[model samples]
Target: MKLINWWPPMLGTGISLKKVSKDMTTFEVIMKLRWYNRNLVGIHYGGSLYSMCDPWYMFILMANLGKGYVVMDKAAAIRYKKPGRGTLKCVFHISKSEIKEIRSEIDMIGKKDYTFTCEVMDEEGEVVTEVDKVVYVRKKDFDFEALEKEKEAGNTKIPG
Candidate 1:
């Protein structure tokens, strides 16, 4: 988590992780409009807004679903609604029931793709950007438990 906190792109864009729930179901991120991150007109950069939102969904799903699943960020799109002049915050949340639903869908289809929407808001709570993220999830074919046991025993090589 500390590694993520100091991640170069996030740091460069002035995006900070405020909180992450113990279960990884919720994450809060804030981006301050600093001199370095501001565009020529002194507003937040569009790329910065998108970077602020890039990773949370996949991170949350991976943590919640554990090693038995493969989770990836399949696609994303961001729409700039207004110029962000100050601090902007975005919260990402995925409920246990949602996780259950995803699992059910994956079990039924062998894979599932889900779209999540998030709104980035300014300090005054006006929407600054809208982001849509599509994540892909599927159960892994290998035995995760055995892999964990092997790693714990200091056997790094995978059996062919």
Candidate 2:
């Protein structure tokens, strides 16, 4: 997690991972308005705002769904409500019931798209941007028994 928080892309954009729940159901990200990330008018850059929201939903869903499933970011949209002048933050959360619903949907349809929304808020708690993300999820095409055996044998790498 520390490694990811310091990943070059994130670091370059002045984004930091503040917290991640033990169950991976919740995540918080902070974006400091630094000179490097500021736009021509000295406010937060649009690209930085989008980058701040890029990975959280996919990451949370993947962790909650386990290695048996495949999760990918399918689409995204960001609506800039106002310019962010100072530090801004966003939180992403997936309830247990929602996780269960996603699983059930995938089970029924073999694949499903889940949409999640989050808001980037300024220091005053006013929304500066609204982001909508869609993720594609489905069970992997592989032998579950074989995958379990490999996992037990410590021969496979399960991504979080």
Top-TM-score candidate index: 2
* lDDT per model vs. reference: 0.88, 0.89
Q: What are the per-residue Cα lDDT tens digits for candidate 1 across 1-160?
A: 7468788998899999999888889999999989999999999999999998999999999988888889999999999998998999999999999998787666544566889999999999999999999999988874556657767998755322
Best by lDDT: 2
Give, for candidate 2, the lowest lDDT window spanning 10 residues: 104-113
Per-residue alpha-carbon lDDT of candidate 2 for residues 1-160, written as tens digits (9 for 90 to 100): 6578778989999999999899889999999989899999999999999999998899988888888889999999999999998999999999989998888766544577788999999999999999999999988864567767878898866532
lDDT of 2: 0.89
How far is 134's C-alpha from truth in model 1 (Å)?
0.7
